[model samples]
Target: MTAYEYKVVPAPAKGERARGIKGTEARFSHSLERVMNDMAADGWEYQRAETLPSDERSGLASTVTVWRNVLVFRRGKAGDVAAYQPRKLDAPKPYVLTTPLAEAVHDQQTATGTSDPDQPLAHPMNTLVALPVASTAPPETPRLGETPEVARTARVAATDNGVEETQDLHQMSSILRDRAARLIAAEQPGRS
Candidate 1:
């Protein structure tokens, strides 16, 4: 196992806002850089800055939050430099689940001769063939004073050639909506 140590420092003070001498402000602000370099030379690496807030009572029945910026640095545990070296970890094992309903479905498919014993069942609505069906019936002439763009066309079949299967687009969309809801629910953290 690896361990780390942290250091917290108050945010660097800014140079004087009033103009006086050229580069004086930059020179004054460089104090923070000097301190950081000095820490780095001692094996500390700069991490990040954070703003901490605390509520303080200002007057009776009122409270104010005071925010303070802090700079953070971290380093490995003392005398344990080897713990920081990168090492490979074994891959996680795959999860296997068995359910009664799944077995029932497999048995029913085998009994009905609808699926091969070695092959998995295929869902009919999972794959849809979308083809533009040419209209053989005579097209209806547009009514008087009606623009051609306003004329509605027949719906094309969403199936393979010469197949009489009908798939409900609304049902497919609802299934997708339900799956998305399940995924969103799984992503939320549980309360303690």
Candidate 2:
């Protein structure tokens, strides 16, 4: 279980010149709601949320006055029978926005002057993948002695040099399996 702090800051009112912008408040509200929903989905129960009083002495216009609200989420403790108790949640890491993987790969390939004939080309930024809001639990690790059949197949394929077709098929299958595993691992819980 963990504790997380989520904040909702009201968008500062725009100047009269910019008052006609569409969807500004709606977008901000949706973003804040999504953050809260995501935390709830991750097994974090809402502990508390409150708005702090705004200071009028700061000379800012009342319409533009900012109200700060905070939401604290906490996971329940484990059962009492456990041998070792889990530690409290650590401070969250700073958020750094990143390009989606496909876009990043495309950018890298373009920078390096290499192009793949098999893949369709598109703008890298257009493929950005938004992350899910809630954090998931970690995946269980595989046992040490559990060797998958694909490993054996790969070994056999490596020794058969005379059969080009079989080797090619095996290599492609191995590549696909590896890629799938990588994607699954990336999506697994406790990744943050």
Q: Please report the candidate that would top TM-score against the real structure.
A: 1
Regions of candidate 1 where Cα sits further than 4 Å from its true position = 16-25, 57-62, 79-81, 84-192
Candidate 2 minimal-lDDT segment of 10 residues: 9-18
Indicate the worst ten consecutive residues by lDDT in candidate 1. Answer: 151-160
Which residue pairs show backbone clashes in model 2? none
Model 2 C-alpha lDDT per residue in residues 1-192, reported as the tens digit of each score: 232444343432332223343576665656666666787787566666667766555556544465666666675545533435566898999975465665666665687576894665455554465666765632244346655565566557767777556433434577788998889988998863
Estimate, for each residue in 75-167, the C-alpha lDDT of model 1 and write its tens digit. 988978788678889999986435654565566676667767566556534323344589986457666776655544322332236657667
Any runs in candidate 2 off by more than 4 Å, and if so which? 1-22, 53-67, 79-192
| RMSD (Å) of each candidate, 1 decimal | 27.5, 31.6
Candidate 1, TM-score vs. the true structure?
0.35
